[model samples]
Target: MKTQTAFPANNLMGVSQPDLKGNGQGGIFNKAVKLFTVAEKENGSLIDQLSGMRASLDKLQMNVFIADKDLNLIYMNEIAYSTLKAIEPEIQKAFGLRVDDLLGGSIHRFHKDPQAVEVILRNPSSLPHQAELEFGNVVLRSSINGIFDTQGQPLGYVVNG
Candidate 1:
């Protein structure tokens, strides 16, 4: 004879109740939907904030390049673009890409040891880092700083050279 249990087998197995079908009502599904909605809204807000910040950075006279957490080049201000453009020949020789191609490219492409650079960029404590980068005959002194969100979570890096 089987003994009666106080709770349902599904509950013991950690399965969601049938009532919580994530149908935008009270349930695990609903909670997951709400979580995703909040996350999307936060991401939208971040994008908007970044857009405004990018506008401000665009007007700066300094050569600035912004990369995402994964080190993908996202923005290169006019000064940065022009500065890189001036050395397009060298850049092409080294990376086989034009300045226009730099956006959406990986910052690692410019480094001799990308894995080492990635280690530093991913560590907040290691920044703001300063280094001199050589491209053929040209040597550029660059300052790398991590960008953080309101919660102090790293957003990316800004390279000012």
Candidate 2:
């Protein structure tokens, strides 16, 4: 008679266990797999919730604009285009002025005199911050907050509702 030899294959963790037939072990293993599956499902759900929150923020009634430190428009949410009109093009389109000329200073254009664009750039981040610009029956109100990057350098601006 010839001798017979059989060895179990290694699992992902490099451990080998006997391949036993059906029993209560199958139920325990199935439950563990179900827990992992549920965990993955929860992770997926959380990602979807975050996505929805972003979409809702974008669709908000308040016009919002994000700009680089140089005042170049990097992002303009939906309300921005609808409410601010040329405001977006001035920052995003670059119009006819060179990049250097367009956004050379900052996004707080109206912070100083509200009508002082053709001649100056001013720093006005003091208290009672507000701006009023007339635009076809509907008034435009803007509040600006400067933003800095992780390096603690002024990187951009955040225009809020």
Candidate 3:
């Protein structure tokens, strides 16, 4: 006997759902369609607006990182990646986490300052903090803030490099 689990419908905001045909690719296509469709409908293209902003940030001389209230990285600009590469070895040595680890999920690996880190995560409006890394060669300036929706409730953070 086989048991079945009920999966939620694809409600990614505004994207469309793909067909679930006998072909092996239908599920994947459906997911992609739903994702994009949902993104398109958010606050008259909120996701697209953010995506455009991200693109502009890539061209900036400075780096940027958007983290959540948990201090887990949501996204990083290209310059940020460059800076991370500059200090890759030291980052890994000191925190034992690769640069990619910063991009959301499981950040306990590279952060040595738990209290300070926690503060930064919890207090989004708190003042920015400067820290010296494991090697002391890289200088990272960080700022955190609560990203509110139209209703002004704390959602995540609009962190920066």
> What ranges in model 2 sit over 4 Å off?
1-56, 85-128, 135-138, 150-152
What overall lDDT, based on C-alpha atoms, would model 1 receive against the true structure?
0.60
Local distance difference test, per candidate?
0.60, 0.39, 0.48
What does candidate 2 score on TM? 0.38
- lDDT digits (tens) for residues 66-128 of candidate 1: 777678888776657766776788779877988887788788788889989878877778977
TM-score preference between candidates 1 and 3, better one: 1
Query: How far off is residue 161 in model 3, in Å?
Result: 3.8
lDDT tens readout by residue for model 3, 68-93: 44556666767667767766776777
Alpha carbon deviation, residue 158, candidate 3 (Å): 2.9
Candidates, ranked, lDDT: 1, 3, 2
Cα RMSD for candidates in order? 22.8, 26.8, 17.8
Q: Local error of candidate 2 at 24, Å?
A: 50
Best model number under TM-score: 1
Candidate with more favorable, higher lDDT: 2 or 3: 3
Misplaced by over 4 Å in model 3 are 1-49, 106-108, 113-116, 124-137, 150-152
Which residue pairs clash within candidate 3?
A: 14-37, 14-38, 15-37, 15-38, 18-30
Candidate 1 pairs with clashing backbones: 22-29
- Model 1 quality (TM-score): 0.67
